[model samples]
Target: MVIADLLGVAKVAAITLNERGRISHWDDTATELFGVAPPRALGRPPAALLRLPREHRGAFEPGGFGHVWCGACTLPRVDDGEPAEVGWWVYPIGGTPGERGVSVLALAADLRRLRRDGIGITIGDLLLAPPDRPAGDAAPARRPAAARLLRVEPALTEPSGDGADTFAA
Candidate 1:
C-alpha cells in the first residue's frame, strides 16, 4: 500500500522492473508518459518494447557496482512519441520500487530535460562513469564512498522581496 501510494503520487513517470527485466510496476504517470496502460504492460521487456537501448540493463543485476545510474537516451519516435534527449536514472534500493524480489526503479522523462534537476547525488557519485580526460592524462581519483545520504526538506514561503532566501544550500 505504501509503495503504491508513493508511486501513484509521483508527478513523473516511474517504472519498476523485476529481476528478469520485465515490467513489474507501472505507475499512472507511466501510462500517460509512455502511452501504455498497466496490467497490459506487465511482464513485458521495456527495452525491446519501447525501443530503448540495452545499456541500462546493468542496473538490475545483483552485486552491481552502483545503486544509481544516469544517462542521456533517446526514445523512438512512435505516434508523436516522447522526448528525444531525455535523461533517466535506475535507483535499485532494498526498500523502494515495489515489494518483492530486487526491484529496479526506472524513472524516465517525457520532456527534453538533460538530467534530474534537484535529485543530485546526495549519496555521492560513487560508481558513476568517470569523466573524460585529455590524452595521456591519468584519470582522477574516485572520491571515498563515505558521504552519507542527505535528506532535504522542501519549504515554501511567501515572497519576502529578498529572493533566494527561501532555499538553504
Candidate 2:
C-alpha cells in the first residue's frame, strides 16, 4: 500500500511542518490521534499540541542534522482523558537546518500494533524492527550511546516470548 494508505491503517498519525515549523499537513490519522481539528492544528508549534516536555526537547525536536528523530513520549489527552504513550519519528526535509526546514513527523499511538504488524520504528540504534517481520524474531544489535541514556535494549521493546532480554544491560 502507498504511504498515505499505510498511515491511515497503521495506527500511526503523520503531520507535516512548513519551513517555519508551523503545522502544514495534519492527516486524518493525526486528527483522530491528537483530537485536534485542522483549524487548531495548523499554524501551531507541534510541541504545544503534542505536550513534549521542555527538558527532553533536544531529543524529541528536529534539528540541523536532518536525521530521523525517534523517541517515546507520553502525550497529553486532548480532552483531559488518560494520557497515552506515543512513539514519534521526525524527519527534516532540507539538508540543513535554518529558517526554512520542512519536516514530516510520524507518531505511533500503538507501537505494539506496529510491532505486531512486524514494523520497528527506529532512530540510530534505538528501534530495529523492520516492516512485517515476526515480532518474536531477533533484531540486530547496534548500541548507540543514546541507547544507554534511553535505557533501551531490543528485549525491552520486543520480548522473545520467554520474557528475557536478548541484550542484557
| TM-scores for every predicted model | 0.50, 0.52
lDDT of 1: 0.54
Residue 91 C-alpha lDDT in model 2: 69
**lDDT digits (tens) for residues 110-147 of candidate 2:** 55455557433444443454455565866654433322
The prediction achieving the highest TM-score against the true structure is 2
Worst 10 residues of 2 by lDDT: 1-10
Best-fitting candidate, scored by lDDT: 2
Candidate 1 to native Cα RMSD, angstroms: 15.9
User: How far in Å is the alpha carbon of 134 misplaced in model 1?
Assistant: 47
Task: List the pairs of residues colliding in candidate 1.
Answer: none
lDDT of 1 at 169: 33
